[model samples]
Target: MRDVAQPAVAAPAYVVGSGRNATLSPGEIGSFLKFDPDGSGGLKPRVDVPTAQAVVDKDLSSTEAEPKDATFSFAGDAATVVPAVTGRTIDYQKTFAGLLDALGKQGDPTPPTTFTPPPVPPGGTRADPPPATGRAVNAVYTTTPPKVTTEALQAIGPATVIGEFQTTGFAADSGQNIKRVADQVNGATVKPGDTFSLNDFTGPREAAQGYVEAGIIEDGVPDRGVGGGISQFSTTLYNATYFAGLDEVEHKEHSYYISRYPAGREATVFDGVIDLKFRNDGTTPILIRTLWTPSSIKVQILGQKRYDVTSQTGNRTNPVPAGVKSLAGNPKCKPSKGVDGFTITDTRVLKDVKTGQTTSEPRTVRYNPEPQITC
Candidate 1:
């Protein structure tokens, strides 16, 4: 009977300190012991340790927890965040040890003992003053997290359009293909040290991909093919990228001169065979914007402006005679207006706007005459 007694016990419960919602109070939090002496000068305890552990395990199982990170969601111009929660749990092993030790000094006014408190994990956060009406905002966090966090992404600013180019005049189907290709290039982002390919970005221009039959120049002859007019879009994008100070990776001039395109400065593309590409040479990201209308196509390159681009054109140098093609009794041969053959020279001159230093890149282009057809 002397060994059987109610002793002071210890169990830790966590209470919300500040900026938190709920609070907690633990149970009796101590131990009941019945100590007995063994025959071989050793003491054995008849204590219900399992019952003590069960009470804590059930109480702190799911209800008490750690902190959670705040989550953000965006809809149109509005942004919302789910707030974070801080939680607590019990340290079972430490509390059990403390309870056993408390039994050794049990008294009417039980001795003070401490139990180990479970750590509180981090939880979600709240933005100050909420977000402005019709303005997008991100959730704030308590600690410094990775860049993928909402706070980090919201810091990025919009791209600035540094250079732009436009071209007009197209057949209806051809214009649609141009619009489709323009849609592919629009809203594209290129990271620094990365290359952007016209063919790779727009992909194959098959009929399945919404391309229509349009006039195309192939093997020095004019023909109709699917995705034919996208080259005009490519040329527009090429000039825009070039004037934006991006480094040209690959480009091909038209085999024959088209009066609509700028002499010695236009580019053309063939699916997989020919491509237009440029590299983002600056240290920042580049964004492409396209505006396709029934009458004209526009491409704009956006990024931090670094240089002033200026180009020079030399006088038309060489001229070749136009060939004659007789189409007697052939109704299928449409009347082809004669195109004069010529040669031209052009150069891209980049000037550092800050230092007024300049550099030049020259190009020579040759155009073959389109045969004069008689029907």
Candidate 2:
């Protein structure tokens, strides 16, 4: 019994990653076994679950990997699919059970053969019995599947440019902030019936996240603050969502209108305080892609086309004249020209391609007058 168990004691058990050969050894198979006296006064080998689990934790824990979902990469007008990766984790309970079963067989004696060997011909030598080989338990592994697979992404069909918008004419610092926010928003995929929030996705936009101090509106006045130009990204994304015929969950317009953006169709976002969000109402997933230049930024929404969308803006009305403020001695004062504020309405028209049905949705926005700064 000892001799039979000796070979099994030194047998190596393996834990392996997916699609790879077994390279990690969870020590010897007999490390989980202990000799104890049976009730009949005979020694018996038993498996220690804790010892087996310890060996797995030490050797197999490090082999775990996180799964990655498939995504799209765009170049110019073309998009390519990036394959998903499978994740691996050790199954401690299952592995311990396998070790215990293998140990039981290792301690058992081989049964006698019942069949007789064939008679050898005259002057022919008989063949010797084959050498016995010990078997070891292989550690079990569990696989975690990625949420988005390549086939699943491909089944959504080829992507079409459903909505696109661009905004330009920004200073260097402001352009940097715009680009930073754009980088965070690019390549985002919104599944069907799922809502995407700009603030939630980008988190806090502070200096640590590469945002710089630029121009912004504070209490209806121009001021310098971190992540100032992020509103341009929010406005761009908002317009794209508008053209995509998606559901606008939440959005807030700027306090004052900037000539660079449409009067009543722009959006602003402040971390935690304000957010820009939209829901994917279509049946397929939508992918957001961003492109930026030195003084300009563009956002594009790509997915299956479901609507033909158009927009109309009403004439600005209820104009309010600007007021003047003198800040000659203030070091933080930045001189700027005053602009009149007004109210305007913007309408989005959507025509369903499948049914040839049309729907019109209108939104009204009001802006505060910009105060003249005298320095």
| Number of the top TM-score candidate | 2
**Model 2 per-residue lDDT tens digits across residues 1-375:** 654356445444443322222321324455666778888988876667776666556645655567767777768656667777666666666655545444434332433222222564422222322322233344455778776676556655777678999988888999999989898877678889999999999999999999999987664446899998898889999999899889989999988788989888999999999999999998988888889999889898988889999998999899998898787877767788888889999999999989999999999998988888888
**Best candidate according to lDDT:** 2
Which lDDT tens digits does candidate 1 get at residues 38-151?
889977665355665465444334434455433334463233433445434444443344343434342323212222334543334222222211111111113333212333
**Candidate 2, lDDT over the whole model:** 0.74
Candidate 1 ranges with C-alpha deviation above 4 Å: 1-158, 217-222, 327-331
lDDT of each: 0.64, 0.74
Cα shift from native, residue 90, model 2 (Å)? 12
Which pairs of residues collide in candidate 1? 9-30, 67-121, 67-122, 67-123, 68-122, 68-123, 68-124, 69-124, 70-124, 84-124
lDDT of model 1 at position 35: 56
* Model 1, residue 56: C-alpha shift (Å): 42
Error of 1 at 261 (Å): 1.0
Model 2, TM vs. native = 0.66
